[model samples]
Target: MSVLQRLLFARPAAAYPTHVPLTGLQQGALTVLSALGALASPRRADLVAAVGETSAGPALAALRRRMTLDPRGADILAERPRVTDALLRRAAALPPDTFGGAYAAFMGTRGFSADERPPVRFVADAELAYIVTRAREVHDFWHVLFGCHTNVQGEVALKAVEFLQTGLPMTALAVVAGELRLPAEQRAELNRTYLPWALQAGAQAADLMCIPYEKHLEDNLDELRRRYRIIIAPATAGAAARAGSPTPPLGAAPPGFEGLGPGVEGGTAAQLHETSGRLGPV
Candidate 1:
């Protein structure tokens, strides 16, 4: 992490005691401040820190439980693998339609860097902290799986999916705040086309934290989505790609990014939360 970034997110050398286990009052204060910061400057590191610090605990527990229940997920937690910028760059060179290829292309085409995501600091348990950190790092992989663009519209749509899937306050906050900031046309598009799709997909898809994305980089992207019960919305680039067809070039504007399919709210998100609360130590 850069020196400035470290200061922004409280990444001190001691790592523990220096930053973890914040008081409830401190957390609440940080949450409001960070949410405001995120609203003011979306995607900035400091702002991401604000949201991340406040909303990570429950998510970590849920993800940790997910990792324990599934063998693949268990392997991932044991391995503690991290996806780095170098890894994404390497993956980008693979066949265009493969998972690694798509991930690389997505990052390359969108001018994003994996290193931009901040690390966890507030979650008290070290293992859970790692889970939260892993979750943040794999966010773009979720984008790849859902086939959402990095645009504000796409982000809000994806945030809806994440909110349903993870029940993270930050994602919910992002959806509400991001909607307010969007142009009328885009906001209408989200409510009319994408929100329902994201909610539905998030409700149906398997717990995303269980998937060891690093292991599937070479797999066919569309096949992977099917295995995960993910459906791309009809008439979008993701849908076209999943149907074994070509999509528009990345340089062109993205269509309604319904990468995750469309609609009934259900018990999956709640179930994950319930299960996480009852988990035994791994």
Candidate 2:
């Protein structure tokens, strides 16, 4: 075998059904090179996925263990549901106030495609591969839940939350690299406003991987956020407005949402406090 092949495929192929099995050195080199590529041009989703895949072994394993313990997450691992184009189309047809509807709007308004996210290639185990793929697919869902736009500020803020939630090294790198790309004032604004909110939200929210999003497509969006303890960052609301996709106002009780229950009208200060108290500590 050639030297490059030996380095890249040092391990036996039996363990990794979905990818080439690389040695530690090979994985590290790939991670560094891909990270540099992503840093130079954050729009390169391929490079970003490469960084995530090459650096994610330990983190993915930890996440898999956590998921195995949660009922919904465990079911998800067994069923292996994908965020397919058909699913997106179905979401697009739902009522505007529903979670799936909001996700459809977020993608349509920003011109993002469900197919844009690269598939997981480097993870060694089938389940871990699915975990990584699930994380990638649900990224836009995270955007809608947090009310974060697709701007640099919004992306960086969401990266902070992802890093905290998944312990993924690539997310931490993205947060740092993204911050460095911002101007002084924007960086300060991110730190002063979004970063704190992201940290708190990330730490307090439930295991998002546990959510069976497909089943909850019809659930009221605002109610979903409340149940999950997700507080949309104040800055995100304005950013969404500027992008001409103003967040559905809180406490909006348009007919159908009434069945979703009370507290949908407007998030009062007491309600916000109660949500925080319910989340308590991680």
TM-score of each: 0.75, 0.78
Encode model 2's per-residue lDDT on 151-190: one tens digit a residue.
Answer: 5666667778888898988778767866676668777887
Candidate with the greatest TM-score versus the true structure:
2
Model 1 TM-score, all chains together: 0.75
lDDT of 1 by residue, 98-195 (tens): 77887887767656677755556666576776666666677778777777755556666777887787776666766776667666776787798889
How much does candidate 2 score in TM-score? 0.78
User: Which residue pairs overlap in candidate 1's backbone?
Assistant: 197-262, 231-261
146 in model 2: Cα distance from truth in Å?
1.1
Cα-based lDDT at residue 261, candidate 2:
11
What CA root-mean-square deviation does each model show from the true structure? 10.0, 10.1
lDDT of 2 at 216: 88
